[model samples]
Target: MAQAGFEDLVETFEFLDDWEERYRHVIELGKALPDMPEALKVPATKVEGCASQVWLHMTIEKGTLTFIGDSDAIIVRGLIAVLITLYSGLAIEEIGKVDVAGELARLGLNEHLSSQRSNGLRAMVARVVQTAAAAA
Candidate 1:
């Protein structure tokens, strides 16, 4: 099951008819995300494989996982916001159960994103899942 925040996003996407509108919405979402503290952007949190510089600082408390992320590219930052909605507040055990690809397809992201962005998204998901597995 997707998180409530993600479900809300899906609803909004459904209301928007054009890809351009959806794209703009995604950028706005990114703009809405709070800045990730510079101190947390260290190599330890840096995600490899993204064309854009990206970092995700994760924390788990009482078995729930959450993260703050940033990306050098604006659209990538929006993608990070999407990922946060998809995965944050989930229990560590639940992370592996999520169908990341299937969920993304619902928003038509798979077809729209460039190969590089798709690969980067996959890498980010991998990082989150790996961290959750280790925590679990």
Candidate 2:
């Protein structure tokens, strides 16, 4: 099964009519994310290239990858949720092959994102892909 919030997230985004609503939805997703343990937010998991402080923790079990992440910025946290939606719960090979940029583009999020946020999002995706590749 997909992660708890994954399918609903995509459906909600598709249902929203405009960027503003989508942005609100994304923020809401961030707000709804379960809090990561403070101990897990160490520098070893810190994501580079993000203007906001962000950390990613990935676990692989029976060939499926799972992720938990956090960010100081609300929108960045939402981007993390988006990354989780795009990449988590797949086999490592599937994660390495996912076209995250294309998916973001298809959602019309890439164009609307500020350059820094876009870079941050890319950084998070890169971390997930690289981690998946390691597991593979």
Candidate 3:
């Protein structure tokens, strides 16, 4: 029910009338993420569906799962930050329980992104969900 990541992203994007500013804002958010662990930098965690190279790391703390990741592309890094914000700090069941595709639809970002990118983003989230489920 809390609008932490996706909602915030939509609100912010809407507030920015210019795509240039929105892009900058996203990059800033990506820059704000905590450093990715060295161990997580391995090729195994690299996301394959991205047009750019992306690395994701997952951690389980208490009952919640958190994610940290990086992308070689700036905008993609920001996008990854957006994904991390929404997907992180959620338990596997909670994540799987939520209508993720619906959330993205509610935010109306799916149409803004290319079909390939949209599918890739979904794939990344799916991998995160699978990883979390496996851990659970």
Best by lDDT: 1
Better of 2 and 3 by lDDT: 2
- lDDT string for model 1 (8-119, tens) is 9989888999889989988998999899999999999999999999999999999999998999999999999999999999999999999999998888899999999999
Error of 3 at 64 (Å): 0.9
Measured by TM-score, the strongest candidate is 1
Query: Candidate 2: TM-score?
Result: 0.92
Candidate lDDT scores, in order, read 0.94, 0.83, 0.75
Q: Tell me the spans in candidate 1 whose CA falls farther than 4 Å from its real position.
A: none
Candidates 1 and 3: which is better by TM-score?
1
Candidates' TM-scores? Answer: 0.98, 0.92, 0.80
User: What is the lDDT for 103 in model 3?
Assistant: 72
Residues 1-136, candidate 2, lDDT per residue (tens digit)?
A: 3344566666777898999999987898799778889999999899999999999999999999989999999888888888788778888878867766667775679889999998888888888888888878
lDDT of predicted model 3: 0.75
lDDT of candidate 3 over 4-46, digit per residue (tens) = 6667777877787765676588779878866677788898898
